[model samples]
Target: MKELLKRYKYAPADQLPSYCIPITVNGKTCGRLRPITPDTLHSEEEIRLLTEWRSASGEWFTTQFPVTEHGTRQWLEQQVLQADDRILFFVDDEDWNPIAQVGFLHYDEVKKQCEFDNLLRGRKGRFGNIMIYALLALGEWSIRVLDLQTGYLNVLADNARAIAIYKKLGFQEETRTPLVKQVEGDVTRWVVAEDDDTGGEAQRYLVTMKVRTEGFYETLKQIL
Candidate 1:
């Protein structure tokens, strides 16, 4: 699998086949793993909510807060407009407003593999299993639509809550890299995903896990 740091020219985001799959829990629609467009309405509040969530959740993500209105627009453009790789989108349900996002950061169609990053769920995510249901929606899409065999998830070793969630999803830890500290200003803790110290720094170290999409679709079909 290719690390996210390595970049290559990818087809335009519009040219790629979209896998914006929605998920339901119990009888209600919880959220979705939808595709993002230039017109997607994610305001500064949503941006700040995600930023605060990541900062509080530790190093699974590295985006910081105080993203001003202008800065938030730039960040959105960077993810969908300026990005040469990775396709990003919102996860919306009841209110048609997004509560989270999913990204295919490193895509290798030939290898049937991709790494997911920028999975952020705000305080209004799910009831209890916030992250699980979101991931299931995306993971199911990865298997069915993308035809991917292996999905890579990067996380921090010390984030037990997140690690347990991944394990339940059948992701197995594969690699761990000793991350160098990179902190700007006063951070209560530092954890990292990539070399971008902008998020914070690695709490302990950076670790990646791999999961196959073999049984995901079959399982989701029965439940959702």
Candidate 2:
């Protein structure tokens, strides 16, 4: 199962169920992660959940995304399906309950680099370690099988909590710039999860960071 995760990109989309990957946080049940399927592509419930969660996480997300269920599904197809990216769903290991969603964005096979995107955490805050494990595994898999030499991701510079987590996972700052202006109508106030979370407000930096292929595998040692 461990080796299979690195090569699931070639698996027939319909046969992805057999390649499910287990994920846990703090030794507690977080969920199982598997490749996206036809069910997730059309499920209205998932559409609602992702839309609501993205809206709630205003300061973190970049764009003014689609809000309606149909619109969200369309966006998913463009971003994950047509974009040649592998999207995975975070679900309960026992009963197959949906927990969250994550995926690679703009993975350039020739460049040997990719941007990680759509990584939203579930509502269970106490089991926060889920993000760490998810990212660690993804980073390892990227280098191990995808022939990737580097992994890149962007985060709000003001999002200290997320930045800290990224650092702990062995990602280091590579560049920083102001994020493109959000075109959402009358954007005034934004909501975030962390209380007293500094550096996340009207003034936000679009920080780009990366972890080398070797560093990704090395991170596993730190976490373990």
Point to the candidate with the largest lDDT: 2
Name the lDDT value of residue 161 in candidate 1.
81
TM-score of candidate 2 relative to the true fold: 0.77
- Tens-place lDDT per residue, model 1, 104-142, is 766776888888887766647545564577778777766
lDDT of model 1 at position 200: 60
* Candidate 1: regions farther than 4 A off: 1-20, 26-28, 41-67, 183-203, 215-224
Backbone clashes under 3 angstroms, per model = 7, 1
Task: Please write out the lDDT profile of model 2 over residues 1-224, one tens digit for every residue.
Answer: 22333345345666776666666555644556676655566677877886776777755766554456676777666655554554555544345666666667666777888887777775653454666776666666667667888888988888898889889888899987654353556454333324235446434567888988778778787675
> What overall lDDT, based on C-alpha atoms, would model 1 receive against the true structure?
0.62
Model 1 lowest lDDT segment of ten: 1-10
